[model samples]
Every structure is written in C-alpha cells, then in structure tokens.
Target chain A: MPEVADPEPLPVPLARAGDPAAWDALFRRYQLPLYVFVFELVRDESASLDLVQETFLAAVKHLGTLRDNAKFGSWLFGIAHQKCRQRWRQRTEVLFDEIPESAGEWEPGPDDLLIRREEEAGFMNLVAQLPPPQRAALLLHYVEEFSLEEIARITEAQLGTVKSRLHYAKRALRKLLEAKNENPA
Target chain B: MKTPRELLLARHRAAEPKLDALRREVVAAELNNQATREQSFKVSLVTSLLCCSNKLWRELVWPCRRTWAALAAVWVVLALVHLAQRDGSPPALAQSAPTAGMILTFRDQQEILNELFADRSVPAEVVRPGIYAPKPRTETVALLAA
Candidate 1:
C-alpha cells in the first residue's frame, strides 16, 4: 500500500466582513459552549442567554477590531465575560431560573437519569457559589475542555491566575460537596 | 484519602447539558439572528455613507462652490476696507480748525451733561428734573398740568 499524507483540518468559518452565512456558521458552532460558559459564571439561564446575545451583538459591531480570526472562540468568550460583568454591575442580585421545559425531554435508564439530574443540580449549586473569575476558570477548564492558556486567553487573565482560579474552584467545590454529604438534609 | 480530579470528571460526565432538539433550535435561531443583524447593519452603514457622500458632492458642494467663492471675495474686500480705515491717517488731524471747533463744542455739551449729573448739591430739579422722575405717571401728570 502507498503511504498517504493526512488531510488538513477544515478551516473555521469566520464571520467574514459581511458574510451572513459565515457568521451564522461560526455562531452555531460556538454558541452552546459560550452559553454554557457564561451560564456557569452567572448561574442564570435567561441572563446567560441575554449575555450571549449582547456579546454577539458587540462582536458584530466591533469585529474589525479583532486581530486574529482563528481565535474567534476565545474572543467571543472574552466579550461574553465583559457583558456578564456589566450585567452583574448593573444588577447585583443573581437569579438562577430553572432550565426551561423547552430544553427537551431526557431519555435514559431511570437510575441513571435520576443520578445524573442530582449530580447536575449539585454541580450547578456549587458553581453558583463560586466567585465570578473562579467559576469562569473552572467552567472553561473542565466543562468547555479549554487548556490553561486557552482559558487565560478567553478570560483575559494571566495563565497563572487562571490556573489558580481553577485550583481553588475545585477545592471549594470538593469542600461544598463534602459538607452536603455530611449534613444530608 | 481523596479522589483525583480525573475520577471526578468521569463521574460527572452525565451532568453536562445534552444536545437536545430545543437547545439546538434555540442556538440556530440566535445564531441566524446575530449573523443577519451584523450583515444588514454593515451593508446599511456602507450604503448610507456612500449615499451621503454622493449627495454632498453632487447636490451641495458642486452647486454651491461658485456662490461660496463670491461671498468669500466680498468678505475679504470688506475686511480690507476696515483694515485700511484702521491704519490710515487720523481724519481729525486733516480737518479745518472750525470743524475741530465744532467737535470741541460737541465735547463741551457732553461735559456739561456729565457735570450736571455729577454735582451732588445741585438739586436734580434745576437740571432736567422730569428726566430723573422715578415714575412715568408722575412726569406725565406734571407735564399735562403744566
């Protein structure tokens, strides 16, 4: 058999200067992860959606300022973080709305579904208690599967700061879970 | 003894948000809206600027350039006349002594008015009493009675 070179990865669809389809593709690809990341930080489903929308709107207005198209995911998240902060500043109280029933039906074995739901609720509660930066760092690091450097880039923080936030967030979450287990009420 | 981070990660995989139909729909709609808005706004802005510049050059600048230039020239001539008047010789010095004497008489009348106003002991009644009346009605009645 003859040896063959590996094909290159497909180029990311950047929202071109005025290409609506390209922008749509980029948004479809990253919106979920970006929304989840913002949701983890703010802990409110509706507010997270609003933040995501505002972030995209801002990105559209200022897309010319972005230097690297390849780093669009991180850039979008950065804008989302700024919008999240603005929302927080404007309204200090945070409200965590239950996930909409429209989020669709879950089909799993009964035990598995129950366990998963409990875990998700517990994890979300823990995440909600974390400070904004630490929560963002943890979500990007673990949930979004971004590396330390990527988290730093997205959060516009130093690499060490990102690492420290993740470390502390994990420790805090562990302690919280342990406390919950001990109480069991 | 504590569990490692990787172990915790494995245990929590199911807790993540699933790619459900509704979620997908919401994401698609939001993305579509964003892309459309961005594209439309950019196109509109470019079109508006182009239209504005074209109208300015064709309807405004070109049509008004001659009028603007003529008005500018008139303004320059008026400015030069004022400047010349300021820098030219004193007309007072060029006048005959009789004309200068008339100017001195005008100055004397002004001086008399100033002195009359300034003199505290001179009853206001002696020098244009009606002129200094506090009320118009009193002066009017006095004039009518007179």
Candidate 2:
C-alpha cells in the first residue's frame, strides 16, 4: 500500500526486535479493518475482538516469520483469517450470541446508534449470505482494499481463485439485491 | 436504492469511525503486555538464525534446541546409571586366573575299548579329554617348585 494510509509505517526491524511502541503502532494501523473483516466472518463483535487480539499477538510473536515487512497488513489479515477458520472448526456449545454482552469502549451514542445499527445489520446480512470464501474475498478486496495479490496471499488461494471468488461474490450480491428490490423486503 | 457495492463501501467507511476507539484499546493492551511476552529463548535463537544468510539451515534445524536438549537429558541419565551400577556392584575378586598346562590320564586300554564297543548293550559313561585343571593354590606352588 502507499504511505498515504500510514505516513510513517513502523519498521519491521523494530517490531521484530520486540519494540513496544512498534507493536502498538502496528496494532493501531490494522486493528479496525481486521476486526471488521473478522466480525463479518464470525458475526459476533466480541469474538471479532478476540480474534483481532489473537492476530496481533501472533503477528508480534512471529514477526520474523513474515517475509516482506511491507506486506505486514496482508500477513496479519491472514493470521486473523486463520483464527476465524479455527473458530469455525472448533465451535463451542454456547451460542456466541447467547453470551452476556460487554460494554464496548465505543458506543454509537444517542445520535448514530439507531442508524448505524440498521446499516450494519443490513450490510452484514447481505454479506453473510454469500459463501464464506467469496464473502471473505469480497470484504478483503472492497472493504479493506487489499490488492488482488494481497487478497490472494491472505486467503491462501491462487490468484485466479481470488479473482473468481470476487467475481462470484459480486455477482451473487447483485442478484440478491435485485431480488430484494422485486420483493421489497 | 444504492447498488450492493456502494452499500458495502458505505458501511465499511462509516463503521470505522466508531471502531477507532476499540482499535486504540487493542493497541494499548498489546503494548502493556509486550514486556511479558518476548519471544521464548528457543524462538529467539531460531529467529536470529532465520535472519541469517543460511535461512535454509534454519528450516533444517528448526527443532534443534529441543532435540539437543533431549539428547543432553538422555546422556546425563545414562551417565548417572553407569555411575550407580559401578558403585552398586562388588569389587572384582583378588584371586589369580588359572594357569595353562598339559596333563594326561592313563586308563586301562582294554576296558576303554570294551566300553566303546558296549555302547548299544550297556550304558556307557562319557568322558572329556582335558590336560589342564584348576588345582588348589598349595598344590600349584608345589608343582611349580617340582
């Protein structure tokens, strides 16, 4: 990515050397986008936060394993993606939704709560309806704006596979939206 | 109605403003815990080696530390066992080993022949031919003097 998103990106060396500020800076740079991507997959904000924490911890721990420091964003996303896959494979008996909710640090307040809730619910419902892999590709591409190569790396799929996933996802979403218009849900 | 792509982008963009607070928290939490979570000794060694020119060597010896540790443990156990076995056993006897020599046994030739031929008709004793036998120490000294 261009330096525009991060004017002074944390050096990979400093992070690899276990520099606290570097790790903090790295976490700050990617946490929101990564959380949104994970929350989209798991459909639980709490679990999304856990997965984000897990991803950053893992990235910080295994920073040396990363080949290109510049692609840290994609690599970190890949770790989060793996965590989501693991959560899917080993689901606990308790419904994540049934769990008591914690007070999040950020509340929408009286102003944005109702509108944000509706938009978030609507967008999430649409995205969730797509096949998991396709939805992941779409989110990584459109929402996070990862390059095609980066998405392919994060998804651990062939470049062509990434393209096809995005292709099928957009087509499926468009079709669903058209049907929704016809039915006026 | 807006297109689906537009809706996705719009939602993503709007969501971030609210999430920035949570992101800040995540950063703070990670930074606070950083000191306690340095890479382990083995991992740090592997990490250093991996950053070297022989990165391929790093893969080959990825489990080197653990393997070396196991081997050292086994060696120490074996050394301890050997020491215990040595201490537990009695010391070797101080007596000397038997000497080498030749001796002869003279028997009745006719009786010997009859016994060889009577194997089927009667139970015959089997005898082994030997020249040397261990004698008492006194006899040994007397024979040596002779």
- On TM-score, the leading prediction is 2
**Pairs with backbone N, CA or C atoms under 3 Å apart (clashes), candidate 2:** none
Best-performing candidate as measured by DockQ: 2
The alpha-carbon RMSD values of the candidates against the true structure, listed in the order shown, are 17.7, 21.4
i-RMSD values for every candidate model: 10.0, 7.5
Task: Provide backbone clash counts, one per model.
Answer: 0, 0
Please write out the lDDT profile of model 1 over residues B31-135, one tens digit for every residue: 677678889999999999999999999998788999988999999999999899879876766664667889999999999999988957766568744545376
Query: Candidate 2 — which residues are off by over 4 angstroms?
Result: A1-4, A92-122, A177-185, B1-146
DockQ category of candidate 1: incorrect
Worst 10 residues of 1 chain A by lDDT: A1-10
In model 2, the Cα lDDT at residue B52 comes to: 76
Query: B56, model 1: CA deviation in Å?
Result: 11
Q: Tell me the tens digit of each residue's lDDT in model 1 across A1-185.
A: 01111143213334544555565555656566666677666667677767767776676667777777666767778788778767766787553221121222212222111123334557667777777777777776554456678778877776666766776777676676666668877
Per-residue lDDT of B1-105 in model 2, one digit per residue for the tens?
Answer: 443334454555655654566556655676666644554666778877778747655665665978878988999999998899788756455344433431122
